[model samples]
Target: MVQRHGDEQSHVMEREPLLSGTAQPDSDYHACHSISEEDTGNGVLKPVPEEDEEQSIGRGETESVKDNAHVNVLKIISVMLLGIFVAQCDGSILMATHAIIASEFNALKDSSWLIISFSLAGAATQTLYGKLSDIYGRKRMVIIAYTMFMVGCAIVGVGQTMWQVVLGRIVSGAGASGMSALVSVLITDLLPLREVAQWRAYVNLVATLGRSIGGPLGGWLADVIGWRWSFLGQVPPITLAIILCSAYLPSHTSTVDEQDAAATDLLKKSKFSRIDFKGAFLFAALVLAVLLPIELGGVSIPWSHPLIFTLLGASAILFALFVAVEKRQAEPILPLDIFHSKDAILSFFILGFQTAAQLGMMFSVPLYFQVTSNPRPSATVAGAHLVPAVVGNAIGGIISGSVIKRSGRYKSLVIWAVTCSSIGYLLLMLRWHGNTNWFESLYIFPGGFGMGVASSALFISLQMVIDPAHMAPAVSFMYLMQTVWMTIGLPAANAIMQTVLRRKLGVRLLELGYDSAEVAKIISDAVSDVDFIDGATEKVRNAVVKSYIDGLWWSHAFSFSCSIIALVLAVFLKQRRLDGHKSKP
Candidate 1:
């Protein structure tokens, strides 16, 4: 039972005993289990006559409608997933064409911005999307997201300058961020917590497949037409998704009762005024201050640069200010009490560490295949190598969802999944030798499978621990956790690779008697151009390949370390049974 205490919600649950031949009560609903024996107008229970069973018959009608509603909800979920799949496709398409785009601009330095711009923009506005969606309706926000994304894509498709491309990506990323966060939130809104696992699994499977195939498709399109077509082609499907959103997506008011409409309207009017804009700005500044330096330091500038230190210091002060502001806000953008549970805190770290490991492997594994292939594989071939991992990811999500749906337990499953992922990362570390055969790519499947299961299960677990009303913001926070970890993970892994590769190549090239300036140029060129080996002499190519292989080993080692930390954290996660009630303790 749910009782409203001013603005806060309090829940009390008491399970009732079942009698023989009694109707089973819905776990989530609060309706009386059945007509009481006393209410039946007799001391002893007796079956009602077919002619006088209006109450029981009415109950049956309500249940039948509910069952049909669930089927309709599934249809809506499928449409929402179309948007997510396209978003993933857009990202992978960009990844595949990143190098080509850089060469067009004649500025390798600008390439990082293509990704960084998107990520930073996404991070900055993630909380805003959550807060705003709560104030406005979800369907309205979703339509706005699609509109913004489509506009951004059009800008990118026509972009002739580097700045224009960067601007478009930032706009696009902000919209995509909303699509990602709101899809999960909307799912929870439409379905019960227990059924979420199965539906989310289906959505996640589409996302994995879209990302996996997008790279190869992008490469093929870029080759046949041009890189610009990659952006243009995706617009059609996004348009279709927008159309679907308009026709079927429900507003928040759909869930409200007719009698409560006036109260809801009053609440809606006040929600916007109560928004913590100051908290939002401070949070965004904090993210940018820390992440920008991490992205730049040790790549374009030294790690010890005064600018990096300044940004780090500024970020600390901003964080302190953010907390102070949030504590006093009438309605904080991100509530302070959300993390009061130890499970929430621990889950964030486990997600962070696991994401770090997953991203490291995602990047380094592809590099290993590209650099070490004897004749050097095409972008298409390198993309194909990732298929096993994607397939494994899809399978894992399906299996995890099925398990969760059947048993309504997640903690043990999460622990085992993370442990399995750690072992998978270990196997990846062992299998990714410099010269690999076709079979070597299969090694990533285990790691991918574990990651897929763990990621989906972790989301379900996090949802179980938080209030249903807070689901959108909590899920958005989780997405932010992923973005933060990914931003740190990819760059950190690249830094390790660059540092290792430069040192190893320099030492080996000097031994081969190459001039210092020439060696430096070669190393720079190799890092900039993905296909630098194609232009180098046989001896130089072989040395560079060896250096790349060595660098990847160190990167994978970093991934292994992250996985170990995640494994330790996973073991401590407390398992709670899904009984459709929030525990205040």
Candidate 2:
């Protein structure tokens, strides 16, 4: 019995009806026949959200209900922007100020763990959180996640040493991971199909804004006061988010879409049903075993060392178990169906590599600066650099958001974004060679802008492809891959750069003119050389800079490749109008 909804009457099939708890059978979005609230459309049981009115041809005798839907979408966009900014800002700030952290902990020798632990924890839990978000409500899950992040930030702020900071970051990472998934899910929950990009643009811009602003802010705060304050800075945005969320985010249950609203829909009301927790465990274990070694390996011993191999072997076992269990389990954390979408799997792979390369650049650039300096910026001074990345990110966010708001589709923006990123990396490569100027960094802003566009486009893309039932899992899965890539890529970049520097710069040092045998003497003497001569040691300084520049070229190369791959992926995606009714243009 579908009770008619609202005061107005419209077309018979297109008539608005609230959920009245009737078991009226329909053949719609799902494979199984069941009664579900459906969109105004053909008699097929579509996914959870059946809001597509275009397909529902007869729905609007007058479009007042349709008008009301638009107003609600705008409200949802505003709420999502708040969450995106809070979470993005947190991730952006960490990279901006890692240099400051290393000095404080006195652990420059073994610093990857500081980065890895937080990343690993975040990656490990994201899938679980994604599933839980679907099981629980996205709004409630997000709020709880943010609170946990804030708690972690607070803990990091008060910590005395590396472990404390690492602990805080891990907690923060877990919370942040939860948001990464839910933010996308929320976009689907809130927007009409056509307006997904329009809605995402706002959140994407806010995220870019937070990152662009936060880098410098984190650096400035750490430079002026202390490194601990970088973590401390996170509290403001998170606290602001909590307050805004409480005020603006309306209550929403994690409603199951018609497609896989519950296992019963797909599997005839299974008497025995629970997600294969064991498989999820194995997956997390697999991620941990492989990732932990990759991140911590080169630091402890060579990459080919027995210890690293041992862990990798164990990881192989865990992954095998995860795959076997998932394939057999009635309900898998990873829906095998999703992988069947070649485009989705390929996109996930590309996106993961892109994340790794991006984060690796963020992780390495500061270290290049610090290692060369006899003494790096007092913790506070160096941290200030984070401000520029933050500002650029914010501006990029705004540009992408504003543009998408006007345009229904993000295809051109995706192409442009990737192109710009490619240019940024190429320019960054040049800057590393000898052109360390702010104008070179203009490339970075565009790169970030491209990232902003890509993030919006990618999030919407995943949403468009999957059944509404799988939306949360798909999002979380994307997140997990990204985290894994970042963990692997950052340290791997570090190892490669270090190895390259030893070969390129170490042997070449002072051989150009300054005495090779007397290099240290020359450096020491140069402190007083200004008194003895024309202060020609500027050449030495340039040489040192050149070394960093050369190493950073690898980052630029990787970024360029990632952007190229993204462009290639674009070719496979059929264009669609954001009008959201389905079937691509």
Candidate 3:
């Protein structure tokens, strides 16, 4: 089947078919063009006999047929962009409406799982899809992902119980994870190396646009029609996107040139032997064991509980086993060779830590505004404050891409990103208090801009350094790092906010002549139901607002610390010029 694709390439090969008015395939691109059966006495090339003309015409017809069967590259990209846009939109759509969902289901205590389940499930399946895409095909995997997303959305739309919504989100997230990795791989397959930077910028822009739409739209949907419509409304567009993608997306095969036939033959024999099931299991186990415990520790159980320690110990053991399994596998899911260089290792950590910081801010900023806004906006409109930051992110990505295209360097942009992010976080940290609108609004732009620059620059830099054939797995690993760090960062910040909010709320409630248990219930209601403060007396409402503001200040401080650490790490990055040629020039 793979070799048949090579033959297909030959049959359809054309020199400037796209440039020339003709859609005909040139027979000269085939082997017969270079090695003719007969040669003219003159030093000029001669056309083949009319007998061979029939065969050449058949090849031309075959080319046209193949063209009709597969969509053009541009159409494929457009459809893929839509798919990614939908996936990203789904990720943040529920952010502003979680309180509503909790209130309706009477499951406020368990509401955190609505977000965590989605993220965790998505992260878990990313690497799995990357490997499977390599083994099977990219288009097939993407279609599968879309189908899952649609089904998950349907489940959430109809769900009556909080646990049902959590399950639906987990399913939705599992499917959405593939869109990011697969879209990235598709970009590399379709575009030239130098051009990829600009295209990536477009993708980043689309992602930001999705987030921008999601936050405000979610708030609006929750306030007017219902929170469930937020999930249901996405169904029609996503379904349309799925149909377009299925019809238009081109098939991706692993590129194996004829010159490497002998190696290809050897690889074919060992391909089945190289699945590395043990390594896959160990990797999944390690991630789940570590993240689940952290997620549940401060939220569901105490941090010092025996279960947390046990899970941590088990995670450490699983890590060692995963390493051992990789060493023994014929073709490891994660190649150890990629980490042999210090720069590659540093790139992973840089993205991990950087993502953790930004994601922390993404969650915390919205919550800060929800509690402190003067005469608070409707539940659906509360996330409008996030719009400016998202716009700044788009601007930063565009600039980063343009600069890299001109100078062919990423180090300076990386440093700019880190500095901007750190400064933004620091400013926000200082400005955050009881006010929703203030200096904090100004700082969000820089913070978002920094994140945009850093993310694009780091990925481009890593691709430049790594081997091309290994790019898919490397990209998958980048996504994994993002998911893991995000899982850790958000939960830790929430823990801090929750603990402090509980303590401060207790004191305020006690001063107002409430008992300890009554104070606990009120604090719970404050976090669980956005409508709580509206019904409370002015004195209690003021105290509740102040407590939330004070608690979130510490969360912002933690995010600031993360940015500072990322900025310090940026100083150590090794700068390199990207080589644009297919093979090193």
TM-score of every candidate: 0.85, 0.74, 0.79
| Tens digit per residue, CA lDDT, model 3, 172-276 | 988988888877766654444444566678888888778767767787888899989999887888889888776665443232344545535533654345566
| Whole-model alpha-carbon lDDT for candidate 3 | 0.71
Candidate 2 at residue 386, lDDT? 39
- Lowest summed lDDT across 10 adjacent residues in model 2 is found at 14-23
Give per-residue CA lDDT, model 1, range 1-585, as digits (tens). 222233343332221111111111122322211222222111121122223456556968655545655656665667778888888988998988887887798876779888888888888888777666766667677888887888788888889998898899998988898988887876765555666767778888888877877887888889999999898887888999999887766433222233444434545455567567899999989989978997888777888899999999999999999999998975577877668877777788888987888788788876888888877777566757777777877888888888887887778777777777777777766777666676766777776787778877888778766654455678889899989999888888888888899899999899889899998898889877768898889899989998888888889888888888888888778887665444442
TM accuracy, model 2 = 0.74
Number of the candidate with higher lDDT, 1 or 3:
1
- Clash counts for all predictions: 0, 33, 2
TM-score pick, better of 2 and 3? 3
Looking at candidate 3, the ten consecutive residues that score lowest on lDDT are: 17-26
Off by over 4 Å in 3: 1-73, 96-108, 158-165, 215-236, 252-262, 270-274, 433-440, 500-549, 581-585
In candidate 2, what are the lDDT values of residues 348-415, reduced to their tens digit? Answer: 76566556556656665555444334444343444444345545554555566566556656566666
| Candidate number achieving the greatest TM-score relative to the actual structure | 1
Candidate 3 vs. true structure, TM-score: 0.79
